[model samples]
Target: MTDMQVQRHAPIREQVANILRDAIVDQRLTPGQLLVERELCEMTSASRASVREALRQLQAEGLVESHNGRGTSVTVISTATARHVYQVRSSLEGLAARLFAEHASDQDRAAFRAAVTELAEETAKGADAAALLKAKSRAYDVLFRGCGNPVLHQTVQTLQHRVTRLRALTLAQEGRAERSADEVTAIADAVDARDGEAAQAAAMTHVEEAARVMLAAAEGPPSH
Candidate 1:
């Protein structure tokens, strides 16, 4: 667990939840791993009450599960569940792309292009998973901001944690990181041209390809 300095001005439970969320998405806390409340309290230097609240928040976000006796564990995303997530993600991202292309300011478009360039450079250099994920997230932030719809942004943000975890899985596949960068570049290009339809198609295609790679990887080696 990373060291956390609780901000005196902010709510501790929210801070704790964000910390735990990042750990899960970064794969530091693997799926199905038991998350003991006591250990979490110690790790975050938070009180039991705060830790429990954070766990509750994570559970609501679908990042963790609780059972009567099994305790709390990180949620294991099945291939079927992953497919559903990707379907929704495809629609949301497609809409965001189209909105950005049609309504974003010139400054927003320039910032998005710069973000995509950083993502592409990171992938080309074979940066670690964490770095690549951060770069991609920066690009996404630009997209969400340029979309100019708080409701759409909030809706997508709700699924951010789960989508990030699946993104890590896809990035681990051989050659996937490079292709993923290219896909984003395509979306960026269409956005720059203010081509709403093309941008939406590229964004949806990116999500679809990521789903394909992730589901295939989950299947493991086929029997001879």
Candidate 2:
């Protein structure tokens, strides 16, 4: 109730929310995995109130759904939602690429180059799925930051969180690692060249490839 009490507990709620969100995104929780408040409190080392509040916030974010006696569970994403999220992500990433190309400062460009190098090294080392995903996410986060558009950056981040599971699956598929490495290299080259058009094209291409891979996987193996 006091300002200090509220401020002190805010981070606990945020930490719980992030942990749950990452689990959902990684499919570790799976669709409809029961989230008992007491279990979460133990798992997160937080009080029941903090865990409950975190679950409530995730529900508001469309990442979880509460069912009276059944308790809360991760939400299953529909194809319609998937398509809409990809559409929005593609548009926003394209804008981000354009902005980054046009407005990246020298420091921003250096940071992007370093991120790209790290991603490339990780991919070449044949890192596991988890490592690859983190590297890939970091690279894009840098790109979004370099774009200098707060609203656009936030929108892409929100959409990314919603579809993180699907994206992880796509990134884990055969040949996707190599393809993603190539895409990242292309985007970096475009930005280095300061070519907005090329950056946009590369960024869209990367996203479209991901969309195609996800759709194909969703459709299951070719008939026969």
Candidate 3:
């Protein structure tokens, strides 16, 4: 089926949820920006019920919050929250890297290596934030698939929206994209060599570095 037809065949609520999730992660729906149900319905061309269902789904994902008498708005990730999220991410992603290294087949490793290469090329070429997000996502897709653990995959998928937003935040910083690409390359290299310990260490280091960069950016210019 055509892409458009496939999308239409999907449940309306899920389609709307994906649309809003993309918008929120990409910052088209900025943090703390109020989401009006009627406007969302108009935007998605979905019914009010579908929009509400989608909003509820995002709320569950910590992407949006609803307030009494105030409706819903995109979530604002405070520095503290971001730090905590990164701590959990370090563990989860480190495990994924180790598993991918230990269990991935030859073909999976090849695809993963290619994905990392594409990500590196994109960063080297000074690709835009959206392009970088797509490339990084493709690499993560390969890593998760090769990891061979359904629980890990599901858990990471739950946190992916916020993880993506934080990644976008880091990528926007000066010189972060190239560094991030290099860090991912390290993980890929370790996985390719089937060194689980090295892959886990590299993955944790990548997340810790991203957390450092994002926290530094969140802190803004130090005292003038």
Candidate 4:
């Protein structure tokens, strides 16, 4: 391949990192699955250096860990740990919603509405997990843009990799996707109406419901 193809958008390393990240997020790379540099290089059609850098980026995002001798693998998420993540996420998301309601500009509100609409369209079509994840990401971008606090936005971003799987899980459950769509509608309405408290409550409710569904699935069937 030519250099133009290799570095089409950014760099080969960044491209590799994004691909690996999406794989991990979609649960194609299951937790505790080892990441071999040579294997990843072949799988991604990237060089060893690009593969290594990609792995390093995933580690920094908390999606993978490099063990002492076992090499790098996807990080596992226990139910309890997932609960804590959702708990903290609910609060953080509430703050973002509140800030967005109070400070979002006309263009921000328009973008937020458009994202919600696109997500709803995809959800109605019974979109696959990867499609839903991408649509959800678009909605999140609107929220982050509208929210006034950059620091708070970045803090949530740091934890996003961990919850990516949870999002997939939540949407996979029957009826959860519909409810989540309604919750986004409520949030968008509140933000457009400039009702901070309503926006915060809607966001909190959304997070809590999703967490409950995801954690219950994580707990799984009881041992005999």
Model 2 has an lDDT value of: 0.81
Q: Clash number for every model?
A: 0, 0, 0, 0
Residue-wise C-alpha lDDT for candidate 4, range 1-224, written one tens digit per residue: 22223444677888888778877877778888988887777667789888888888888988899898779999887788789999998999999999999998989989998998888898899888788888888888889867989999899888888877789879888898888888988999999899999999999999999998997777786799
- Rank ordering of all candidates by TM-score, starting from the highest: 1, 3, 4, 2
Candidate 3: residue pairs that collide: none
> Which candidate number would show the highest TM-score if scored against the true structure?
1
Global CA lDDT computed for model 3? 0.92
lDDT-based ranking, best first? 1, 3, 4, 2
| Cα lDDT computed for each candidate against the true fold | 0.92, 0.81, 0.92, 0.86
Candidate 1 lDDT over residue span 93-180, tens digit each = 9999999999999999999999999999999988999899999999999999789999999999999989999999899899999999
Runs in model 2 deviating more than 4 A are 1-10
Better of 1 and 3 by lDDT: 1
Ten-residue region with minimum lDDT total, candidate 2: 1-10
User: Model 4, clash count?
Assistant: 0
RMSD after CA superposition, every candidate: 1.7, 4.7, 2.9, 2.8
lDDT of 3 by residue, 1-224 (tens): 12212166778989989888888988888999999988787677788998989999999999999998689999999999999999999999999999999999999999999999999999888889989999999999999978999899999998898999999999988889999999999999899789999999999999999999999999988997
What's the TM-score of each model vs. the native?
Answer: 0.93, 0.89, 0.92, 0.92
Least accurate 10 contiguous residues by lDDT in model 1? 1-10
Model 1 lDDT, residue 175, Cα: 95
